[model samples]
Target chain A: MTNTSQDRILEVKTLWHYYGNTPALRGIDLEARRGEFVTLLGPSGSGKSTLLRILAGLELPTDVNVMTLDGQDVSNIPANRRNVSTVFQHYGLFPHLNVRENVEYGLRARKVPAADRRERALKMLEQVQLSDFAERPIARLSGGQKQRVAIARSLVLEPVILLLDEPLGALDEKLRIDMQVELLELQRRLEMTFIYVTHSQEEALTMSDRILLMNDGDIVQTGTPEDMFDRPNSRFSASFMGVENLFDAKVVAVSDAGLTVEVNGASIEGVWTGASLPSVGETICCGFRSERVQIADDSTTSMNSLEGKLTSHIYKGKYLDLTYQTALGPIRMRSWQSHAAPTETARIAWHKDQTILCPKS
Target chain B: MFRPPTHVAPASYMSFVLIWGLVALLPTAGLLLWSTLTMENFQIVWEPSLQAYRDVLSSGRWQVTIRTLEIAAIVTLIEILLAVPFALWLAKGTKSAGVRTVSLALLTIPFFLSLSSRTIVWRGVLGLNGPINAALLQLGIIQEPLDWLLFSQFSVILGLIGPYFPTMVFPLYLAFMLIDDEVLAASKDLGASPAFTFWNVIVPLGLPGLGAGIVFTFVPMIGDPVVPELLGGGNVVVLSASVQSLLRILNYTVASALSVLMLVILVAMISLVAAITARFAKGGL
Candidate 1:
């Protein structure tokens, strides 16, 4: 919740990384406050995991202007000397060590006394609810238990920041949800900074206090979950965030309220969500969520109404997805209510407040 | 549709085990039985006796047995020390595929040659007039050709090392290759230094292969008749040489007794290695 620089625990500036000749991270700047759960959400081949590795000191960046952890410069420190831990995607626990020894490894490296190390390791294992499994071999553990042991191993080190690279990506759906809640609870309880990298947007939206959406080696947008879902600033962000309807439109009139754009010879009203206002006669993209559309019976007075024929209906258990072929395109709507049969002519209307207009690129 | 046989018949299984036991265990049992009988007047005595065992101690053949064990143990230790780091580098250090392939091919090439032929090349390299002495003389490190470099314990041990090095390396290479890079990265990320990671993670995970390498190198070095014969220059007599001389004199009972002693020592050494490795790596390997 604290977003100011005074409470910043980790800060990175101008970080660049290249794998051979291909640039993976391009001059990215990142800042996280104390106890902030910041999620880097991106698809595969995005620079999210690379950025996390550099922050954890497991990787050396091609160039970095400055990096600090807890106000201490950590740009040159290696992973072992740095006070940061990482939970690998496959839960890379040592196969030779038992559960307790695996957790005690970091303490042993730091030369903690035997009695104190055992006590601390057992206490951390108890926190992860794996105290009974202290003597168990790593091969005997299930997937979820291995995940918990991986977490316990990192947490026992008491690092400044914990970097998780798709830690729950290996779990099944039910267990994944369970671990998501458990992870959030653990982070809140310990008040530790967690930098999680995941490609699942729903997981990011559900867990993060701030989300940095990355694409093509750059973070295109950074905002809260609601802001990201409601008002995406680019065409990529809108499509990545599950906005179903998008149209290419040219602005005809600009007013204080919003802009009126001409879409397929029909004048549509939408609010501008970009940083700068677009002048009249400028081309841009407009998008809206499928759930925001409604079947309007009296469409003659509405400002953003489209007349179309219902082409298909998909039953999705919790909701129905209705596709309508209008002059603009095939517009899809997610409706919770049962609608008219297919081939019925209907008018769909969306409020201007629910509309989002951004740059075409 | 054709389906493979799921289970073999019980009679066939028993017969298969019987055939293996006959081909393997019967000869060892015969040697043990023969060691207990003594020769009388150039003919075999039916009476069993411990005279051959007593003669082994009195004739000082036991010293040769101990010397064989000592040299084998030293050479095995040296091989382990050299092979581990080389195997580790080959498995995880270099990123070049060509280097790995070339090194593996080199290690495997010696396997195709006979041990005598492979070891003969080292004599040419370590002899007084060999390239090693030539190089040392040319570099001004030695005034004369070093006689100790050939036909000594050093030369015998050196010859044994080259022939058995691949045996030590191949198993270790396999074990180190199977170690996940992520596990090593996790170790570093968990605040362990490089040295700590090598001792705690790399060594324990590589124990099975280390055990196999030790057995493969040590067992054969004890009974090898070529290296000590060719390089020891008739001064270093081992158990195999004593057994050969005893057989030439028709001392079959004492020869069998010495062979049984060697077998006992080998079993004990292998078992000790297995116990230590098993203790260090529980539920692993």
Candidate 2:
């Protein structure tokens, strides 16, 4: 299902925010389609949380050209007047209100009748599998249950957009993975636009339909998780997505297939993955994922190969991480195959298509 | 395994409890006993009787007790209404640390001054020819100086509010400060207006402080002799003033009876507040 303008639930244009003189976001544009799970993936202070807060109307941007929610201009609306709700990182449920009462608060604020409020709150609690916990105090809840209640409290309002500010950050690893699945399912069933902000790349890859990779107050790349993982467009994006074998190279030759780059007197062939290809003699960065490398045997006839001395091997449960000292620097590889005894000298080979070129900066 | 040393030993704990009982509880128990005795021929009669309490009822001293409670309740309510928003502003609304520190220092200044010294200043302000009446007359609001301005129950209540206001504000400030900012943001994000958030989230979460403010302001206000003496100008008699008059006549039994009655009223009020707070703690406001 391709999303067009008619499907866009939230649109922000030319938004900028500053804390006094320090800018947090520098004139960024964002859009989310109906029922789409868009993750703002970035490190702390990358403006992801600031963008979410602006969307939820909890924080006003320093300047904005346009902001629309569900086809209406909401640039001037306060948080309480907007049709957006945020699930805070700490699951800021009211300690003075019980589970169901916390859920009913938004409805009550909107002046919904008492009977309808209770019924709707109970229904939302049941959807989160917390029907039995409706009367329990917030202090009595576990971390995961509190997260569900936070989500339920926001969803009970039936807002146009739901903003989640690292809502699962406090949970343990297993529970966090489980909650990610639950949240994805919940968003799918509700058909509500979800704007989730998190710093974990794996979480973005696992849960997002589209990911916006942010760095240094700007969104450096936006694409599907697979596209972001395989075809990062910048040095920042490449390293952020776990591409460990990155080297500075000078382009020596360009062809229809790819470009040949020289790194430390070694000619390496890498695909031109960017929108525009650099001409010969331009300096650039080349990278490839460690899992894409393979140990080349004597019988193998791969032209793209590197010979280096074995440095170290770490035995991970699922894969072996091997590092080699090469002319270009240390090249790391993750191998899933059961390898033979380590040799001092080894040949590591990768396909040209697996190589990615990024801007050196 | 290494164990942390205990802070209080068993013997010390017992002795501390004993000392507290001897210092605090013994006097109240003695007063309770004294209230049940009778006085005759200007001598102490050790026989237990309810004649002192009976005399208090017949002599119309019970009216003073009821009136004192009414004034205390009214002043506590007024302080609550005034202090909650001010405390909220001091704790959460204001952004400047300097402003918060200055405001807190201002609230605490009254505690450093004597109660009589602070209360005596109000007499000059509330008197018939005081600036308040002069300003009212100058503004064409009143035709003549209002004689009932200083020496009435109104002035007594007015005088009591300023001395006890800091008590109400301090606890509320602490409570409001402890509330997390994200909880408030979540409330607004969930579509609660500012007013709704105040009543639903801020007030309910501030119950412990509200209960404390009420007890701190109300209990002391009921027994305040200085404000009534200075502002009431001996025109309005409350329980404390009545107890003093009974003592002056060497009626220790009746004085102790009045003190015991005041204690009963205060305990009943505090218990009601504690019960309400406990219920809300389990459920919600």
Candidate 3:
């Protein structure tokens, strides 16, 4: 995917916001570039939505200075003066207007001339592929149709930026997937700057050019999806992504090759390449995803192998989920169901790089 | 519903409907018949004539109808114009609940207060030597107490506005609140100014409330007697007072005829306005 230009379309410098005496956002210095699809991926209460509201000018920041839209100072500008459009999950279509009227609403407001408004609205409705239903009352529309009309309404305005707050949260799984594909296509075609917010990790990975993973009102990491998945920087990211097994281990030795760690009275060796690597006797947390652990066959296994009793086995579509009681406590592993039958004793092993270590609190 | 076999019948439902219809229509029919009968001996009253209708359509009685329409139209126009700005302020103002509650109190306190008491209070405030006149004098803004403030068309209008302004405001406020925040954002993002947003998005969205407010405030004002009787003195005679005079004198025929005329005019006004509003609304009434 093409990245947005480094020249910022909007910038915030040390922005702060509060509701009454409670702070919702504190010293948030964020920027959005032109034509970028940046997803603010966070759990709720992480200030992602609040940040979007501030950017849209719906809520005033308590203390901040900011520039927006080609370096124009928009710190004190009201919502109506800012060049940003927002689409909410509710799809907020005016019930009293027809689809065409709703689409033309912004154009008429800007005094784009009556003749031109009609033409532009028609063109926009066609873009969303709702041209046949332009004259239908909004109340008569289905949920997806209403969403399409709302998108058309926002798009017809030709805003500098579009902020979508969980736009597909209300849709069913099938419809949500369809809308996500359509939205990505529209974003590419229009070259509009998009700031999408969602708590769904799948949506963040699929739609964002860059994901800003937020937690507790702070961005934990901002990087590509591959970087986030293959090399998570924090325990929170690792756990949130999919790591199912974690254990506190003590580093016994480190060399240019690898490090040996002790966990649950068992010595395990792992690659130690992180910048925050610990010294001898320092405590660290080791993690591995459920899918990465596998049953070790003594006939073919070479390194980092363990012998254990099979506690339970679950037959998943493509793999068998096996729980084993190992010297390092209970560890979960996934093996192809076709290759393995449930045996009381099973040997398990994984590569050293598959085991990740983080500084233990 | 599909027709059943001869075992079940429809007599019971039809009988119930007939009974309810008779119960509703009987009083209106009785009133119409009795009003048309000329009074003689109690049981022998008969021979209806055009005399009652003539009296109602006479110059002396017709002026009250005209006067009532004039006052209602003026009040409706003023209320709608004033309420639009106030509604916009309420909808787009500070989101602080305390501020909103206080502003709403300003509208509802008088709205719920006794209409008579509010009129009496205004009567005192707008008196020749009342608080308003005294303040103007004390501020050296005027040397004379303004006679236009009391016992004139203005005071009557003021009294009507004081009691009925919230009717205009609450609906318009609701309409404005119903507008989506995204619509306003979209307008701004497209380079719309504040004034343009108000004219195009805010006004069109709130038009239903405006139309309803005008009908609710103006329609009742036409038949209301309290404001004119207290503040208007003999300056204005609305249709309700005319109906009252005929009723008091036992001229039920003329009273009924005058009511019918007013009802017809009110219905026409409502229909005309509704048609116009429905045309522009695009999707709904």
DockQ for each numbered candidate: 0.60, 0.69, 0.37
| Clash-forming residue pairs, model 3 | A296-A347
lDDT of 3 by residue, B1-285 (tens): 765544445786678678887996666566566556554422425677655567767758888888788888888888888888888788877677888789999888765766777787777889997999999999999999998898888888888887778889988888888888766665565456877766666776777787788788888898888888888777777788888987787777777777767767887988887877677665432
TM per candidate comes to 0.93, 0.92, 0.84
Query: 1 or 3: which has the higher TM-score?
Result: 1
Q: Which ten-residue region of model 1 chain A has the weakest summed lDDT?
A: A337-346
Assess the local accuracy of residue A11 in candidate 1 as a C-alpha lDDT between 0 and 100: 90
In model 2, what lDDT does residue A260 have?
91
lDDT of each: 0.90, 0.90, 0.79
How large is the i-RMS for each model, in angstroms? 2.0, 1.2, 3.6
* Model 3, span A275-339: residue lDDT tens: 66678998877777777777665644235667888888888878888899989888888776646
Which lDDT tens digits does candidate 2 get at residues A50-75?
A: 88988989888899999999899998
lDDT of 3: 0.79
Candidate 2 lDDT over B129-174, as tens digits, reads: 8999999999999999998988899999999899989999989999
The local distance difference test score of model 1 is 0.90
